[model samples]
Target: MSKRARLLAALVVVMTVFVGAPADADRGISVPAFYTPPSSLPSENGALIRSEPLPLALSLPGLDGPLPGRATRIMYKSTDNNGRPVAVTGAYLEPTAAWKGPGKRPLVVLAPGTMGQGDHCSTSLALQRGLILGIGVTQSTVSIGYEVLAAYRLLAKGIAVVQTDYVGLGTTDRLHTYVDRVDEGHAVLDAARAARALTGTTSDVGLYGYSQGGGATSSAAELQASYAPDVPLKATYSGAPPADLLDTTTAIDGTELVGAIGWAVNGFVQSDPSLKPLLDKYLSDAGRAALKDLSTMCVGDAIFAYANKKTSSWTTTGQSIADVLRSEPVARAYIDGQRIGTTKPAGIVRVATGVNDNLVPHPQARTMAANWCGLGGDVVYVPVDNVKTPSPLLNHFGPLLSDQGTAVDWLAARLAGTPATSNCGALPGQ
Candidate 1:
């Protein structure tokens, strides 16, 4: 090879080596360009558009059940799954009649699990019922209908809730990280920072999420102390979060959900460039086609694309997806770079999962509990019992919402100056 060409190839090799370094090894990924305050309104045509005092007669059909106590639309910017600029639009809800006085209420940031792709999926109008709680899911509709009702109950208690439509999923940016924690966590916490920066703000805040939201919430909590110290974080509740990315990758080795795993790989790769070569090499034409086509696709759409389609000896086209993911420097870096538990002494934290959680496994939560306690972090790991089944939603997604009351009570106490407990005992039992 010519000297210049050899030099170029050498540079590429060097870049790959540094990009794939471990979590604390080196911060190799390029930081995103969007440093706009989270409170900035969305650019026109963005996935999450902000319009304060949300129109009562908006387009969403399922949001007419009850009126929120108090509501306002918020515009903010959160990095997309690919670490690009994504304008986030949200609705802040507070119970109007519950706390009639001028006292500031505790704020709750609700990061929801996965939902399908569509305009209707990013509904913020559900906050109309109150408590900053409402439908948070795919870009169109929520994964579960009753979640809106639960938000209403929480709002009635005079809490501020900020729900985020994760970076790319709400609008069309071409990637949703699935369970990739860091980016999702940044978006989730920034929403709170954005909400706090708004004209009317609060001092105390907490976070709540299920499934994908669980992972996002956990990440946000871990990074909360250092990332947003001014805004006190009382507690964080995550249901069935994929806490350990490496373990999650192993658990879903050859399952139908391998397609979702593709999205995760793409997300991590986008955030850190080192994995690009691996993605380019291991991903077959079919795999590449799947990633390109599904970057903007939602949950159901991805499932449809990879269903029963096989390449080589695998049952589905996802085998190549996993192969590329395992070989990539970016994947190795991300798995090693996960920022779980506390980044700097965090406040109270709670994680709950069904013993049978299939998508996000109970073992992951158990491991998280142990790690946090080992770090001297106050953690509460609740094992949800009602959802003791093998169904996808029941096992992985339902536990977070199943014991909503208990989780909320725990948070409420923490915000009320009550110290939280750690589940150090349950860690070994599992």
Candidate 2:
């Protein structure tokens, strides 16, 4: 067996123990509804695990569609962001017209924001994957749950949706790199590819994500041109994207969300070997335990517990995770590498940010836009402002849910071959 396979098997065993279910009884790990795939997949050691594609007859009546009709589900497998083989069991909502209309259909790659995965957590993979079905969390009434309403938006529009369970969260592996670009990007793009294989649809592709999803979309977009040139990417809609990891780290350091960020960084280090040793010394027993516990935590649980609090003072006195990271050249190099868009962009890109976002600050988005422009990337930067709340400040996690119409419209224009203005106003090094 490959190293990845061994790792996957190990994770599955660990998850089974934590969830208190027999291996055979656990069919698959459930992900957020929006990010959930249609198929039920068994856990595997490889990054991309395979399962029977979800049956296409599930009915959803709440959300309107880009197209009108029944949606279908399928199971697929692909490499995680780190090239580990894994399974991505998700559904594809397709408008009834999509079948007869044309040989091609535009694709919407939906990357879900945070959802918890602790053993006791409601959004745990055990819950997301159907091991525990009949969940009361309805599609429209999602609080900290994985909502599948957004998938319908693309399906109704005659576009196929591709969603993945990422690596460890769904099936029990190591970590979910909340916003780490590479691994998240791979899962996002791989889902798109998986969708294409199932439908054999050949049309322009568009990317859409919010919060951590934004970071995944950004990673996929930046890498699309080089990684999947044949994808014919049309546009990317990233809401509150964590574009600059380093900048975001600095912005959220020592705050409540610091632990959540640290959890993600732990995943990043494992996926990115270069960052491991740099941060190894600072990971106290408590910190490591927290990371392990958080591996299965959904986004809501992870962030709610640590949003405004400072980092735990349990580590060696006077030492912080940041301090340790800063002292390591390998960690610094890896962090700096993600500051700009390194991979070639496949099509038009839209980057949205909430100016007052305490989670991922507007400045980080601005800096990312600037860096993209400096690298000659095609990008559109949008800053959301609400008249009542704050003119220039958009809620960190609210824009995608509230103003998806705007984002969808922008993607529609791009699909129609319209040009998008790049935010090159402040280029890097200016």
Candidate 3:
């Protein structure tokens, strides 16, 4: 086999060994009982409903090591896009090691990137189980991806990390809201509040994420001022944020990550009930089957299942989802509402993107940075110019490894209360 083919085979094998079976499997795949919330949720947002200590052995899965702190699984109250009460699940890690830094120990709200649309794909579960692979045979495999490692790095710094599963992914039976800005932002901020209640520390907070989590962190930065003003957000590090869904969806379609389009559509149906009928009207039988299959998948499975699958194949009119978005008023409206950077993040914000990232076009990221800077937001825009591989997928994944340490250091400085210098004034192509 060719080098690329060998690499792909190795990845598939590794993922298969680690992930083992679909999340719906009768054994091996464990979904916590807390995943089932009470019939009626509490009215208060960020209220801690329950908590359980997770031993360190299970806490640092895939890290090949132990964490610096104790981990707690928490089911907390949060609001959905419509501000309705909902239950969210996440893991809060409090370092056993003491913070040697100045002021109170810092808390970092770590928003994870796209895992999948299934509840079993929860980041909290992945952290505890040490597997980042998703459900199904085609996507089965073990891979330790960025989010957990980043959380581990932050924990090593004596900073508490609260990794949210976002709304619906961990607790609710409903579909995860995916990239819906309001739900994602609310979930991130509220996770912070819930973390404070669990840890009883009012430490300065920082937000960090990439890809889908990046969008959440960026949205949290914008919503923190109005939604949860009391939660002092010190800084935000958003890597390859999908600031414009309209542009991003178009770019992602027909790519290896086309499954994400199905995820997004599932989210839209969940968030806006009216969209379901519209989808039913426009989607072909194949499209309906694809969505159902996609719903069970994590990111890895989705990528394998829908790799380079044309969106046009799923639609009744043979139009790509991106084209349908432009033509369909309801879909367009819902997608438009997910666009980020409308409000300035109330603190220093660092936005980074891989120049060669084919999944999330770098130009859109630049536009987002420029928009924030124009609105007087302190922005540090870093474009990852190094391309480790010729493949678009590798270009997107390479920067996560290359820049992880730098991203951590940036967050550390912000948590240390050091003033951040802006590169907005020197942003290229501005």
Candidate 4:
């Protein structure tokens, strides 16, 4: 077996041992009814559609314990890439501890990374359940617990947290629009607006996310000024963001996390129906089957199932999907639309990436920061120290663990209204 395959096999064993045999099979599982929007959605975006108080136990599922906060699940009005109205679901948690900050209590919008394409993969559901395991054989519940733990950290600091599941991930029956710049940004910004309307707590906002969430947070930062001008965005912390899709998709191919490519393809086709025929002409039977299966899987399951599986195997001409992307005009257009750094964020933005990150590619991340800086945006570029590991996955994941504390502190400082120092001039190769 190849190195990536061996790593995947080991991961399966570890997950099985730690998570245990998919318990109860139905304990915290429920099909969301509100995922489907009404035929005539309200023209106004960011309007609160509905809300209910989340039980305390489900609010905090960290290993240490539940957080001191009140959780509420909210369905809010948002917009699709075409400016059509849509309904997005998210969780709002108000810490019991009083706000010690200057001006009203601050709200931190937490955009979760790639969880899965299924509805059961909802972050709000995971937050409410406290510990998210397995809903069925189709779902992998590995990272839900960690996600809640991360949110708990913000809650502990007396900063209210609002987690957006992104469009279609948890609430919609349609395929989740993974990595679509506008859709993800709209979901995040709308979540902030919905939280402000529903809670009436604060106007100050901070955006935090890594990996896929990082991309969303970065997109949200750029869109905040034009999309939701009323929302006061304080700071944005984006870690390992896939700011440039053309580079990111090429880097992810043939890696353990290659399944993300499939998610991106599905999202692109779903957003623009015209792209469907273009993809169909290139995709092979194997590719179709793989995408079909991947659509139902969470990140954990996808990593294992498609590890080291090249996109070339999915094409009729035996050409890699990356090659097709470059050669095909329709594919190129769709991908180009997803690129970030075209607009500067309204507030100070901090970007972090592992020096040896293999999943999203370190150089592209540097380019993103540089592009933002060149646009006269205030940016703090942090290249995490490299990890000594033979496994490529570890090279990508180690930074997320090592840099968590620093990211938390940086965001906390932003929430505290501390002036951020721009290191654009100091960025490598600048």
Candidate number of the best lDDT: 3
Candidate 4 residue-wise lDDT, 130-177, digit = tens: 344553454444434346645766776778889888888776547789
Deviation in Å, model 2, residue 410 alpha carbon: 1.3
- Cα deviation at 89, candidate 4, in Å, is 0.8
- All candidates: TM-score: 0.73, 0.73, 0.90, 0.89
Candidate 3 local distance difference test against the native: 0.80
Clash totals in order: 12, 41, 7, 3
Give the 10-residue window scoring lowest on summed lDDT in candidate 2.
134-143
- Residue 156 of model 1: what lDDT? 47
Give me the runs in candidate 4 sitting further than 4 Å from their true place: 1-30, 56-66, 130-143
Superposition-based RMSD of candidate 1 using all C-alpha atoms, in angstroms: 15.3
Best by TM-score: 3
Superposed by TM-score, candidate 1 places the C-alpha of residue 364 at a distance from the truth, in angstroms, of 1.5
Model 1: CA > 4 A from native: 1-50, 55-66, 78-86, 100-103, 116-120, 123-150, 171-174, 253-256, 303-320, 327-330, 342-345, 386-390
lDDT of 3 by residue, 1-430 (tens): 6332342233333332244563454222546687888887777778898899864323322232343567889888898888688889998988654677899999999999888876778887776655544345444532343376688678767788999999888774687888989999999999999998887768799999998988999999999988999898999999989999889888888878888889888888888898887787789999999998787677776776678879899999999889988888888888888888777888999999998887887888888898899889999999988574656567777777788789999999889978889898899654
The local distance difference test score of model 2 is 0.56
Error of 1 at 95 (Å): 2.4
